[model samples]
Target: MEKVFNTRSMIFTLYGDYISHYGNVIWIGSLIRLLKEFGHNEQSVRAAISRMNKQGWVQSEKKGNKSYYSLTDRGRARMDEASKRIYKLESKAWDGIWRMLIYTIPEEKRHLRDELRQELIWSGFGLLSTSCWITPNPMEQQIHDLINKYDVASYVTFFQAKYEGMSDHHSLVNKCWDLDEINARYTQFIEEYSQEYKLDKQKIANGDMSDGSCFVKRSLLVHQYRKFLFIDPSLPKELLPGKWIGDAAADLFTDYYHILEKPATRFFESVFEN
Candidate 1:
């Protein structure tokens, strides 16, 4: 809601933050009205919808004179995978062992190998070397499913072992994660939303804040935290250093989200009310 001007991104956000709950379908007119509130032009919205259709992310149907759109199977699957990472409220208890994936795809299949790298990263593996990836959490199922998806299971080996490093735990973590930058984002999110949360919260109580404003602010809140799925390995707390900002950030996010959810849902439901 408060970021770049990519029409595709706005459409995806609309689905992830709202449309997904609204039966994953929307009338074209309703989508246009919503996008216009976010400063998207009608043409841009249509073009973005077309591009998404080409990519098998969304499909459109016409009923009488009005159009409707919904996620395709591919699109729904993508959203489900992302939601697993983004909306997981807590990590399972750690077993004090790290899961490591070591792979060697053949040179001829280099493109698949490159694609595998992105999958590993998004699945929370930190690259320790060109051919080695590691995660503090158990990733047996994740690694198996991934390599199987790429049909490269034969090229990959898995291990579960405790870390025995030359340096301190902090150094070991720093070697694999950019915790500073990640924590900075948490701080930035807090700065951006902390003040508005209180004032807007009262406005909602007093029947002053409009439904439109609630919708925008709630989506922005989700977008701010959603970036972590790309960067956060979601390592266990035992693996994290003292005074971790991620903990604080999680607390702040939960509080602010609860404060906003009711009013936001009220607005969202109003959009579809007959």
Candidate 2:
């Protein structure tokens, strides 16, 4: 089956997984060449990068009539955070406290409210109710940043407290998020990538896979795993079910990533530095 993609998102994946490692910059022509492997044409690449530049994720430079793009400070920060999360092999230990955020944005500022909700979810916050979000992770700094970003201090309240309810923490987790659904997605990823990984490993051993092909496979691997960032909360080990598949998936992703990493970087540098 063919994969349906968003050009802009694919650009983000390239920047995060490949470009950042190579001086965090790329010439427009090289980027266009790299993206062509995925069926994205020059026009699509130009349009996507233009939109990203306008969105403050990248800045353009003119170097002797050639255009180059590099991540802005905001974009680098996001990529750094995403890289850390993407490669995390295990969940952090929990302190047995939940951080809860409740917001009451006025009707006039509904747009900010909507954006904040997405940010919350991306930060691993689970919805407990209409306007209340909860997470077992430490998010004081993230909460402060969110409030400052949206300028909604007056409409939001934050709390860190232990749950002393009649039901267990597991029940609370169930109330906020669907663990089973998330597990199913992880299972699918494992099934899909595990086979590819074994096949690629053999191909690389036999000198059958080209460096350019390795680059494409590695990009797709990271892109696929990155989707879990939106759906998996990366909850503490204590909060997860007994038979969680996320850890197994993480292992597979890490192994596969390493198998593709050297040749992939070689391919990327050949295009980027030429």
Candidate 3:
């Protein structure tokens, strides 16, 4: 939910351009140009490049003050992981309707207005225009209930109809499900980190917490472990048997909140970015 120029996003932005152009070499100038297209300035782009190089995600060769970079195996892995997250964030199922609503609350109830708006966002509703929100679900009654509960019924109007069939909902679903490769990559990441950080599963299971040395390593491992339950938050608890799952799910949710719902919800938000 907090905006940051994460390594994942930077990998995707660069790899996306490479794939688009059918080329393997990405020059410094080209990286700058692509970042500019994504609304980033030169300094930010340079910082991302430096970070990537430092992390061994990419390798650069210099020729007369010009640099050309290519993805290392590690970079490819990161890009692969990012692609899967993007797919999960994008795919959805559609039951036809695109629900809409227009509400006008009393001026004095601005706090209520803000709360309702946040609720809608959490519920996968996107604003199509001021005072109007859209969702792929046909459950207008749920929206009505929210409005009434918030006491905005006095100034609200609701509408619902089938979205014109212009979107590829099935393609979106396929993308999300194409995460097996990403899952494999993450498993590899966990195994490597576990060895590097000397994470002892037996000790952790036996209640020994002293092995927690690398917080960054621990955090990255936990994040990847959580992707298994991204689409279904209520997955059987037996899938993850450790205190880390219990203690860290809440925090990791912040990083992965977008994919913590049904595929339909993901599809609607991706197709209709508010």
TM-score of 2: 0.96
Per lDDT, the best of the predicted structures is 2
Model 3 regions lying over 4 Å from their true place: 1-93, 138-141, 165-274
The residue-by-residue lDDT of candidate 1 on 1-274, one tens digit each, is: 4435577877887788778887999987778777776788889899999899997899998888988899997688668877776667877777878788899999999999998998888778888877899888777776777777789978989998777877766677788889888888878877877787788778878989777787777776777687788898888877777767877777777777777788777777766522
Q: What is the C-alpha RMSD of each candidate to the true structure, in Å?
A: 2.8, 1.5, 19.1
Candidate with better lDDT, 2 vs 3: 2
| TM-score (C-alpha) between model 3 and the true structure | 0.33
Poorly placed runs, candidate 1 (over 4 Å): 1-5, 61-66, 106-109, 166-170
As for TM-score, the candidate ahead, 1 or 3, is: 1
Q: In candidate 3, what are the lDDT values of residues 108-186, reduced to their tens digit?
A: 8899989888767544465666877765544466576677667787788887775454656433323223334434544
- Model 2 lDDT, residue 200, Cα: 93
lDDT of all the models against the reference? 0.79, 0.91, 0.50
Better of 1 and 2 by TM-score: 2
Give lDDT for model 3: 0.50
Reference-based TM-score of each model: 0.85, 0.96, 0.33
Question: Cα miss at 61, model 2 (Å)?
Answer: 1.9
